[model samples]
Target chain A: MSSLAAPLPATATTAASPASHEDRSSFAFLAIASLFFVISGIVALLVAGKLQMPTLLGNIAWLTYGRMRPLHVNGMLFGWLLAADMGLAFYLVPRLCGVKLWSEKLGMATMYLWVVIILGAVVEIPLGHNQGLEYAELPTWLDVLVVVAWLMFAANIFMTVANRKYEQMYVSLWYIMGAIIWTAFVYLVGNFATLFTTGVNQANLNWFYVHNAVGLIFTPLGLALGYYFIPKAAEAPLYSHRLSMIGFWSLAFVYVWTGAHHMLHGPISQWLQTVSILFSVMLMIPVWTLVYNFFATMKGQWHQLKDNVPIKFMMTGTIFYLLTCFQGPMHSLRSVNAIVSKTDWIVGHAHMAVLGAFSFFAVGGAYYAIPRMLKTRLHSQALANASFWLWLVGGLSFFVSLWIGGFLQGLQWNDPSIPFIDTVKFMKPFWSVRLIGGTFMFGGILLFFWNLLATWLHRSERPAETV
Target chain B: MIKKIDKNNILFVAAATGFFAIGGILTTFAPPLLDASWAKPAPGLQNYPELAKGGDAHADLVMKGRAIYVRDGCWYCHTQQTRTIEADTVRSGWRDVRSPVSTPDEFVFDKPHLFGTRRVGPDLSRAGGKYDKQWHATHFKDPRSLVPGSAMPPFPWIANNPAELDAMVAYIQSLGRAKDWRPTHDYEE
Candidate 1:
């Protein structure tokens, strides 16, 4: 444990490196977003518990399972993960472009506006001001605010890149730029366009929004960070620029067609489902190419996993991304979709992508950037390592438990002889395991947030020699 | 052209957007607006008869009930779409009778469609008339009383507000019944 927690001497060189005075907004965004990360965990814990014992907060209309579920989903996806991604974007775009941000003031304004959007979600979603769409639950007005905030963010990123000193862009820039464009289109279609339509067509549109919200928005942001930080952590250049290009273009093409896979075996057209299945399988091409590129970059740097905390988080994220991508395409198969589409298995699979894969990348970004931004050593490396392990173990246990529980539940649902109540009863032990796993994961995130906050506050006893 | 895209930010953004729009337009944007079959309502949903049932006052209650259902996040747990699978047919059927597969017309009245992805409970697409309004009321008050070990949260607040409960029950009954396809008596176990 002592060796694992040993102080990183590399921080000294980075601390001596030139500080980007323009990164103030990045620092503020990362810190505030980390706060949401902690709060979202608390909401998730309560929601997980309520699933096992429905009456835990049964009487409270606001905390009921229905309202709480969306609150938890939106809070984590939008509030924590997305906000952190934006912060990473603010940090990466400028450095990669070799320029200060176009306007730090606008960046700060975007951060505050984002906080307001999340706070509005926290207040209004509980009051039943929901849109009733799974991921698009925020009311129409808040949706408008989100679009406005994103516009401000995109303006900053695009303007910064436009003024870049370097003519040739890195892979990270392409991903970030692609994400911004795709997000605007996907979000508007999901939140606004669906308003005019109802019934089956609306359901078709809803899933298009749901799947792309993850694929177009979070996936690109996560990859942008991973592309930047993975090589940085491994101390190597990307293995193949051509491979990265292939991965990007292919993903952009294949991902949008696969959203209908969510509706397989349902009432939507069979041709549409078939198209989705084909694209879903094709998704493996980009995922594997990216995996191969990352692993190849880290070819001889494998031993760094023992000592470098950020690389550990990132490499593990890469592996989770692989597993999640593999599982996702398989789930889209008609036979598999029949059993698991609505079961707890889908829930577990979702967490594997968001919590296990992308969350790790975002956390690694913080671990890599925060100290550099602050010009200080981390408050405690040991605590950071401990948080990583706890998070890994907790996330895996939570996923595996549900995978087993939901599979059996899906099998039982298919069997007419087994009563529905018995299937619900069978989930008890698995839910309990999930709750326990959630607790550890929550504890780890709390430590992570505290470490970063403590570093920002200069709370560490170590000398602040740089200042 | 590739070199120009690599060096020019605006050109690169244009290329990225172009690639994405192809798939987006093909899959999501085009289908509902242009497709012929998707616009056809099922015979039951051909008219908003369910909404017009019992004159304006009853229609108001049903609308209010739908609001409560959405507000309480009921759709998170219970899906409104019944797939064309044996499991759904077996599970949503009345006793041993197979309920009709959910057609597009069945959901014509559902604005912002409630075809939820997961079924934490059961698919409620054909849930209309499966049980009596009284049974739903009792279940809302205390789900465990009727179905022990049920994970459904008790909506005791709705019970306290009798009007709201009635509206919710009405809305629940209207789920698949907009077509009046099933006999109410056939649903009992």
Candidate 2:
């Protein structure tokens, strides 16, 4: 499986090397970001396990399941996933655009601001200062900080793009650019910074913001990295540039409308719900295009899935992306939502998209990009392989268990004959399964982070010539 | 070396910015797009006509029930209104069939539609016709005893004595109300 390890053409590094100072600084930022994520992953495992036995945490105010659950989520999403994505973007965008970064100062400042904002979130969310929305758990003040940080990051990236030496913009550039721009717009509107003081429009705006945060922001970034890394690792070009373009536009068109799908079966207007459902169903076109393109690119290159760790991650991430999207549309169906709209089913669906799809791609991008950027061989391919399997299995387990549990709980709750207690009792078993699945996922995350740390810390003493 | 911004890129930026501008404008002028009627003011109590009617007595019970609801945080989980659908109606037992077919307006009386987002417990929109006072009392006292894995925290203080229990039951019964109707039979399993 490791047979694809041919040394790259020496010509790849012909361009002038930027000051080593900037490269080392970027590595330092990435290392800090990686450490934060690894810590968050550990905390998530602890929280998941503690929820199974609430008394284990001994009634500490900060450790309660209600508060800690959001902490775990925010920590992982923003602290880990967003930080890694930004770090990778900083590294990859310049390379892909055939130019040096627009401003290392801006990148460093953004990183520092991000750490401060995430610190505020880590403290506030668990301290019971949340706004009570699921994904929008951070209080108004921290949210503003995030927006500012994002603006700085966006400015840096856009400026870099503006100064690109590449004549033809690559597909990866489009995906990254779209992700950043759409996220800035969506974050502002969804958070309702303008109308928020009214209080009357909070719920509407909350769902709008929460859904798009995932659909527009994280999803696009993940797809961007996936598109870039998959082909790079496979030593192949993209299957079709036209298909990638169609996928990008269609996704942008469809994802915003689908936010109302979360409000299905609620007090939202029927027309709004109908619009959401329609857009959700229409999302299949973009999702399928990307899926088809990736799979088509692998038509004759199936052997790389086992041989290359990055390909393994990308392939599995893409597969989960397809499933998450398919499940998304199905769950949006009013008939299906009637049963599982508010249950752990949504949690399972979210994990599939966030953890299974996005996290996997992020890791794959890191694995592929980091070694190249550092000009060193990975410390252990075997560990990377193991991490891939663990993450893949753990993620699958979590998805399946929660999906079934959510369905069963929904069915039982709505059954007039079955007393609500019976439903709760029925779910005890599933809750136990969820805990186990969560443990597996946490373990897998630990393995991946461990491999990453080892690779970074134990690289060959002399850096290979720039490539 | 800064590359010149091209016409195509400028056009793209204008179009993208315009899309959001239009979205914001539409969101502003759009009629309250959400159906938050359940959370709206209902001048008087409303109940399902098909269920047993309780004229003035039922209205009093419902009023008493409202007090109990405020006291117990029943609003935390159970929503009081069902939307226009067979599944909703079937689950909550509150069908609004004024004409040959039911329309969305049937739930117009609902203020701030407590049609809640999560169901930590069952829907109490139609609780008045669904269960007897005894069942409500027992369940309130200890949900786990009845429904083995119930996440609904027990309201033992409300159930330790009979007077507190009656108030709780009264609130459950008052969820939906109507005049000129009598519950034909006592609520049963």
| Number of the predicted model whose lDDT against the real structure is largest | 1
What's model 1's lDDT at A77?
Answer: 94
Q: Which CAPRI level is candidate 2?
A: incorrect
List TM-scores for all candidates, in order. Answer: 0.95, 0.79
The candidates' DockQ values read 0.79, 0.12
What's the CA error at residue A235 for candidate 2, in Å?
1.1
Model 1 has fnat of: 0.87
lDDT of candidate 2 over B10-48, digit per residue (tens): 444454445434443343225254445423434444542
Alpha-carbon runs more than 4 Å astray in model 2: A1-29, A54-58, A193-201, A460-466, B1-9, B18-148, B152-189
lDDT tens digits by residue: candidate 2, A317-431? 9999999999999988988887887677877898899989998898888888777666677767887888888777777777888889889888775655665556656666666
RMSD values, in order shown = 4.3, 8.0
> Mind giving the per-residue lDDT tens digits that candidate 1 earns over A1-467?
12211233334444566644457678777777788889889989999998888899779988888888888899899989999999999889998999999998898888888888999999998888888887999999999999999999999999999999999889999999999999999999899988987776888878889999999999999999999999987889999988999999999888988888988887788888898999999999999999999999999899999979999999999999999999999999988988888999998999999999999999999998888766677888898999999999999999999999999999898887898889999998999999999999999999999898777666345545664
Top-DockQ structure, candidate number: 1
| Model 1 misplaced stretches (Cα beyond 4 Å) | A1-19, A459-467, B46-55, B178-189
